[model samples]
Target: MSSDDPPYLMALPDPVGAGKQKFQLCMSELLQLVRVHLPGRMAGAGPSEREQRIALRKALGYLDSDYLIDLPEPFFGALLRAAVYDPDPSFNRQFVEPLRVAFGARRTQEALLEVLRTGTNQERAGAARAWYWATLEMVEDIQVRWDQAALREFVVNEDIDVRRCLLPQLPLHPSHYPGELHPLVAEAVHIGRTHPDEYLRHRVELQVRTGI
Candidate 1:
């Protein structure tokens, strides 16, 4: 895999296999929760719970063809959580895109930011992955806010996964931060540059070279 690619993209089996298993477990739990909280939602899947689980897994955990806009408030919230906490970043959009279509771009971004700020390391990493899709447009204020939050988290979060996920989204340039906070950006850049993950290192190198 190229340096810019996520570590999970490597041919190695352990990370990829483990991630897939985690994702499957998450989907199963989400399906059960949905059935309890939104009875009859899975009725079309068939009466047997095994059939319903299989159907939901095939459907990527979305119950119907409505893209989830028709789902009630609590279920939608649960879906958003599942999306941002999903271990496999590639599959997160299945849940995230529907929420974006239903909730609008700004709200989606705000929700992701909230997760980045407060979630566990895994969820924070997932939020960083989902942020790419959440930012459907260029809103300067929101972009700045997200950059700041991401940078702050990157500096303090020692989790390699979180750092790898956040690196691509951070504004590595010092100018993006206020004078007092410029050091924070510099520190983040240093961390990225020296990080053991080649993806993080290469991303920071490219950003520095391109001044992006």
Candidate 2:
């Protein structure tokens, strides 16, 4: 976790510890616990790495059908964001896979798109990262063409995070890039070139070179 993790987390034992303690929290308490504890347990300095993993696993376990229905949209969003912002790439993927299963890809994607369109900046940023990871799984299971429809929707979105997420993940293969996306690619290039953020511009430039 970053040093920036909030102070409240300090009171909670490491998430792994909480899981092992088996406090028998009901779904509501578990959800509330995560809302309070996850940022510190998942994001900040660890009491121990093992404890952190245990905590994450415990939290993911709560996404079972009984608990899933009780989860508020914002709580679900926080779960996705936690997985997306996790520092360890391999572990991040491992942790989020259960979330994907629990949430289901199609519904998760729908929610993410909505967040990208209308949620606050933090939600949109989290949605962008979450969507990128989801696309990684999607690219392999389905034909490349499936991505095109989502790409079309994202390309027109005014949110820079949405475009940033889609542009980098656009398959660098011929099959994925039908000519229809050219205008969108060009538009992205324009936006990227002029964008205030240097990192975003740099990412978009790669698409520019590929001629999208």
Candidate 3:
């Protein structure tokens, strides 16, 4: 199988480790634990975006200090993997936002780019999932680099999950891609047209229609 093939397609053994298992469990219990440990930090009805961001930070501090202090790598990866793989986009910010804040946006973006370029299929998908939150207010140049990398991955990666995670974030319009890279955008459109996943087709159609 090619490098872009996902583990399942290659019949590879499960890559998840003890730390990841524990992190998944922690995520399952996250809301309840946050309520217990950081009561009233969560906003009430109709809270502003800033209020919600503050609440998320407070809860993350509690988790880092208490729950995840002992979590190891091969899963935690200093919370980068955990943050990206988080099933909930909104809750994923619990990890992504803190990394950007603590490490600086440029550094965080570089780390994510590394994951996208060389990590496992799951990691690549997670990086895509976490990309938006990490790039908030980032410079256009950095954003373009990420866009190019993601577009390349999307064209070559046959993993449905990875493609699904990447579709919404990819720049579908041809204008967004440079001259040499325009073919990648075409390949992505072709994949979207041919891929079996309904979500992928729908996202691609929507993006193409909107020219975004």
lDDT of each: 0.69, 0.49, 0.67
In model 2, how large is the Cα lDDT of residue 82?
56
lDDT of 2: 0.49
How far is 96's C-alpha from truth in model 1 (Å)?
Answer: 0.6
Residues forming the 10-long window of minimal summed lDDT in candidate 1: 9-18
Q: Please, what are the lDDT tens digits per residue for candidate 3 over residues 175-204?
A: 887899988889999999888866777677
Estimate candidate 3's alpha-carbon lDDT, on a 0 to 1 scale: 0.67
My TM-score estimates for the predictions, one after another, are 0.72, 0.49, 0.68
User: Candidate 1, after superposition: displacement of residue 87 in Å?
Assistant: 2.1
Best by TM-score: 1
CA lDDT, candidate 1, residue 167: 77
- Number of the candidate with higher lDDT, 1 or 3: 1
lDDT of 1 by residue, 68-187 (tens): 555556555655776766665666666776667666678778888888998877778878888887776545677888888998899999887788778776778887788888999889
Which ranges in model 3 have alpha carbons more than 4 Å from their true place? Answer: 1-22, 25-77
The residue pairs found clashing in candidate 3 are none
